[model samples]
Target: MTQHIQEAYGYIFEPKLIEDLCIVAAELDFKEGDQLIEIGQYIKKMPLLLNGVIKIMREDPDEGELLLYFIEKGDTCAMALTCCMGSSKSDIRAIAETDGTVLMVPIEKMEEWMTKYRSWRNFVINSYNNRLKEMLLAIDNLAFMKMEDRILNYLKEKSKLAANNTLNITHQEIANDLNTSRVVVSRILKKLENEKQIKLNRKSIDLAL
Candidate 1:
């Protein structure tokens, strides 16, 4: 556990703070598609990613869900930090993008560490800033980018996260994440394939660009 903490966050957190985290943090393992946090659920623990990826999403009562951003190893959810600070319910859903491990730190320790450790405070602030930027990028994509461009960018991001050009994902999954229809996704994907940007496969896509 200590080694995991060191590997994930040693540079961001001081040795003393890391030791404290190791003492209080509970290790959790999650599989792909596991719902780590849900909308309207009260947050009890803040997740610090140890390995793999987690996708944060926002729900719309009428439009379904939109993917906000992806948090990978050494990252923490800024929205989760906000909920922890306010003692509020989660407005976003957090799902495991891959089989991963995380350290679940008690909410009470959030404030305590903020006051006690400068590194923790800095990390919290930086996380909030980073997440805000990602949210803005998501908004920009939705408001300005064409569906095809958005789909390509989304695939590129997924590919980068998976560290592979080929992605084992379906059109429906892409539609859900992008908050669009499967028909639209399929059409755009076909266009992309025709343009030699990506190769369509059975339940997978191979990037050519």
Candidate 2:
């Protein structure tokens, strides 16, 4: 597990929700470029990243492509509760941006806990709080940061989450993630390289920070 997870959700390890639920927490590992999930797949479980990084991206069937936004370690893969009420707002593709490890919790187990135990609500509350905090942070960045600043911040955040000063991200994917053009992303990357802030290659970045 990354140190950030302990810093973020220390409550998950407490003895609170262990009684009624069969906690199937395990350290699952994956390599870079691996697809942990595909678009439109039924998200029957929530995944908690224990280490490394993952991105939650949306595919455009109309445009014939995808846009990527990172979900770092300690973020949940499935926003089940929100979509449980209606036609899913977003189709998620979980990309293992770097090697990753995660803990899986099936929704059925959580449902059982919700029915049988009052304390199970704590987990749900915590999950929503964390997700909301991330969403708000995303909004703040989009509103306040320039395009370059957004890219810089994104790389820096992913670098830290990746447990290294290097980032494994595709420029095209980042462009899609930031809602910018690919050529613009390439130009920004060049600027970052000239400034000695990062070294960009075909599929990854060596972040100087």
Provide the TM-score for each candidate, comma-separated: 0.98, 0.70
Inter-residue clash pairs, candidate 1: none
lDDT digits (tens) for residues 50-125 of candidate 1: 9999999999999999999999999999999889879999999999999999999998899899899999999999
How does each model score on lDDT? 0.96, 0.66
Residue 94 in candidate 1, Cα distance off native in Å: 0.8
Indicate the TM-score of model 2. Answer: 0.70
**lDDT of candidate 2 vs native?**
0.66
Worst 10 residues of 2 by lDDT: 14-23
Tens-place lDDT per residue, model 2, 37-108, is 776666555666666777766666665444345666556644544453243643666778778676666666
* C-alpha RMSD by candidate, in order: 0.8, 4.5
Q: How many backbone clashes does candidate 2 have?
A: 0
Poorly placed runs, candidate 2 (over 4 Å): 1-11, 16-29, 61-69, 72-74, 81-90, 115-120, 140-144, 168-170, 199-204
